[model samples]
Target chain A: MKARIKVTLKPGVLDPQGKAIQNALGALGFDGVNDVRQGKYIEVDVAGMSEEQARTEVERMCRDLLANTVIENYTYELAP
Target chain B: MKARIKVTLKPGVLDPQGKAIQNALGALGFDGVNDVRQGKYIEVDVAGMSEEQARTEVERMCRDLLANTVIENYTYELAP
Candidate 1:
């Protein structure tokens, strides 16, 4: 099975990377792009697991490996 | 309008950060995890646009701001 994890900075956090990207967009002539928040994408592959197991295991992966508990949040979905 | 963007390292690129996470997962006893590829997640909010236009505009935002095209690729879906 294949799973995708989305890890992001928590709300109320100041994302300097995101702010830098926002400035870059303005410089590139993209109009009305009000804001940008940057995070992380992690994809993992597993074998011999049911979809439910994949979700649970992958969630564990997020909490344990991919995301920082202090300042990040994560959500994941299985690739169908 | 709301959109979620996923940016990932292109295949064939060595992802050191991902490898580090994989090692961490192994240390944490996540069994049968074969690989990890790390990337980016970005969320943006928009107003006064149709879904079609949002897609286009957001794509521009991605190429212009959120993603580095040299070694990264990106995909996004609208939040309905």
Candidate 2:
């Protein structure tokens, strides 16, 4: 199974990197951008696991290592 | 309009960060992980624009600033 995960900063959390990107976009003459938020996209390939097992494993991975739960939120999907 | 963009390293490109994550998962006793790849997810809020215009603008942003193009590929979707 393959797991695709996205870890994003929770609402109201500061994101300096996103801010920098927004500013850089403005400087590059691209207008109309009001806000920007950046996050992480991770893909993991798991061997010898059923979909249910992969889901459980990936959820644990997120809680244990993939995310900083205090300020970030994570969501994932699994595919064969 | 809102644009959700994902920027990822092209296949065949080495990803040291992903390797480290895989190793860490193993160290944490999480097994069965065969491979891991990391990427970027970005959300942009555009003011006063139709979806078509937002798409065009965002495509340029991806090409010019959000993605390296040489090593990274980007895909995006727009939402109201």
Q: Write the per-residue lDDT of candidate 1 for residues B13-55, one digit (tens) a residue.
A: 9999888888888898888788888888887766678899899
Put down candidate 2 lDDT per residue, B14-35, tens digits, no spaces.
9999999999999999999999
Each model's chain A TM-score? 0.90, 0.98
Compared with the true structure, all predictions reach lDDT values of: 0.83, 0.96
lDDT of 1 by residue, A1-80 (tens): 88888888999999998888777777887666677788887889777888988888998888776888899988887985
True contacts kept of 1: 0.82
User: Candidate 2 on A7-75: residue-level lDDT in tens?
Assistant: 999999999999999999999998999999999999999999888889899999999999999999999
- What local lDDT score does residue A69 receive in model 1, on the 0 to 100 scale? 80
Which residue runs of candidate 1 sit more than 4 Å off their true CA positions?
none
Candidate 2: pairs in clash: none
Clashing residue pairs, backbone N/CA/C < 3 A, model 1:
A41-B39
Candidate 1 TM-score over all chains jointly: 0.86
